[model samples]
Target: MDPVVHFELPCNDRERIARFFEQAFGWEVQMLGPEMGNYVVVTTAEPSAPPPAPPHAVPGCINGGFFTKTPDMPAQFPGIVIAVQDIRASMKKVTAAGGQVLGEPMMIPTVGDYVAFLDTEGNRSSMLQPLMPQQ
Candidate 1:
């Protein structure tokens, strides 16, 4: 089974967007790596879910983050990526389900492997599988 682990944000001015997020939601922005063009990752320091407590404890919390991309990248590849166990199998299912592959699957360097495709509704989305080997 697969799940959505991260989401990318397509922005024209990364700094401006980062500032807006910081000021608007108190989201901590940590600029990762060198600014290679306008592509960057905007991360919220907050945890995805509140620290798990006993079953009787209070409810958990959730947060979000960003990954900047060249304006064109988003058009070519939407900012959303869903997790998958088998990329090839998923692609096949996507096609069988009336979807289409936008482009070939590509490795995302240190991040992971991803492929872009259109859902049955013709909306752009991606599927990703982590590069790390399971223990």
Candidate 2:
């Protein structure tokens, strides 16, 4: 089964939200520029220093981000991102399983291909096919 690798939510004031999370939970926040859609990345826990993690992040730890909410997007509620090996196949699988793929997958520079979708229950979620490891 594909694992849930990330979480996401909507934010209004990026700076205000960043301060709240940093002070409250001690989470590190990275506010992206407008070129990156002004996304706010929240890193709850960094990768462990003692043990090696390879390409994976801190074991059992998932990082998430915040997106600017827009009225056109339905169910702007919190969502999770599932890691997949093949997004096109996964999209087809989601359709076969009664989920609706929202739009075409967009690549996040140095990140991966991402797309949102609606589950069978109409809940918003996302899928990510992380970039292939470079040699």
Candidate 3:
């Protein structure tokens, strides 16, 4: 199963949203620069710790981010991102399963190729095809 590995919260004011989360939940928010779309990364737990093994493990302390709201984007609400092994195959599956794939995937430097989609219920979600490490 594809697990939700990340999340995103859209906000009109990036700094304000970051401050609110920091004050309310004590989450660490790092605002990225223009080259990175000014996205804010919220760290809810220790980044160095590995996720617990499955079957015996329940998800806990997953980190997320806040993105600047854009008028042109559809389903601009809080969304979860699922990590996929193959983006092209996943995109095909999304359409076959009655989900609407929003747009072409874009490369995120040192991160992955990412894209968003709207599920059958109209809820927006994202998927990431992580960049493989170079040998």
Candidate 4:
């Protein structure tokens, strides 16, 4: 099964949101600059880096980020990101299962392709196709 590998929270004020999570949950938030859309990386556990094990090998813990709200985006609430092997295949499955896939997948520099969707129950979530390692 594709495990939930990451999460995202929308925020109108990046600094305020980062501060809230930092103080309330003791999460470490790193604010990326404007080039990266002012995204805030939230680390809830130790070893703030991605697990050294193979993708999806880590259990029980996942890291996430907060994104600045954009008017063009839909379902801007808190959402979890599930890592998948093939984005196109996953999108097809989502639609066949009565879910609505959002817009086209977007590429995150140094990350991978990502897209959001709405499940049959109306919960919004997202998927990520991680970048492959260089040879």
Candidate 5:
């Protein structure tokens, strides 16, 4: 089954948001630069090595990030990212299941193809097909 691997939320001040999480919950956050859309990477838990983590992160725990809120963006509310094996197939499934795919999948540099959709409940969520490690 696909698993929730990440989450995202809209924020106005990256530094302030990051500092809030760091001070309030002891979470570590890294703010990216303009080239990366000023996204904030938040680490809520230390990944427990691998293998035993079902991949790399501990079960029931996931990391999330923050993006700058903009006027033109759609579905900017809080969302989660689910890791899938085939993003194309998943997109089709989303449509067949009555969910609306926002747009075509976009490649996320080293992360693999990613896309966002609105589930039947009208909540925005995303999917990521992570890049496989090379031998």
Candidate 6:
């Protein structure tokens, strides 16, 4: 992939979050796995649209949903993150957009560069750039 173009949010209730996105932005999601237990890919449902269509995905647009892990299986889950091309550039925009940086940007060996930030509404999320491939 060129970069991370997708994002998913962990929710206590998949259906609720799904519905929120649906009603909020008119996103049609296809649920996978048994009884809505798998991933939900967001898509558009306009009849005039082409098949295998991609939804208008972005902030204030469509979003994915995932079931939250129980306390007993805390180790099995992780929070979702937003991908960015340049972590440093993203941090500047994030701050200018009325968000506060939670911590300094630092690199994780063999992993990526990242930093956490809180939106003006106090919602927390991280902007990250995956490590460059070795030559």
* Winner on TM-score (1 vs 4): 4
Q: Which tens-of-lDDT digit does each residue in 41-85 have in candidate 4?
A: 877766534555433344688889999889987788989999999
Question: Estimated TM-score per prediction?
Answer: 0.68, 0.91, 0.88, 0.85, 0.91, 0.42
So what's the TM-score on candidate 2? Answer: 0.91
Local distance difference test, each candidate: 0.62, 0.87, 0.85, 0.86, 0.88, 0.60
Runs in model 2 deviating more than 4 A are 49-56
RMSD of each candidate relative to the true structure: 5.6, 2.2, 3.9, 2.6, 2.3, 8.8
Candidate with the larger lDDT of 1 and 2:
2
Off by over 4 Å in 1: 30-37, 45-79, 133-135
**CA RMSD (A), model 3:** 3.9
lDDT at 82, model 6: 73
lDDT by residue for model 5 (1-135), tens: 998999898999888989898999998888889988899988888878753333336667899999999898898999999999999999999999999999898887766898999999999999999888654
Query: How does model 3 score by TM-score?
Result: 0.88
The TM-score between candidate 6 and the true structure equals 0.42
- Candidate 3: residue 102 Cα off by (Å): 0.7
lDDT of 2 by residue, 25-118 (tens): 9999888999998999888887775434323477888889988887787788899999999999999999999999999999998779999999
Clashes of 6: 0
Descending-lDDT candidate ranking:
5, 2, 4, 3, 1, 6
Q: After superposition, how far is residue 132 of candidate 1 from its true place, in Å?
A: 2.2
Q: For all candidates, what are the clash counts? A: 1, 0, 0, 0, 0, 0
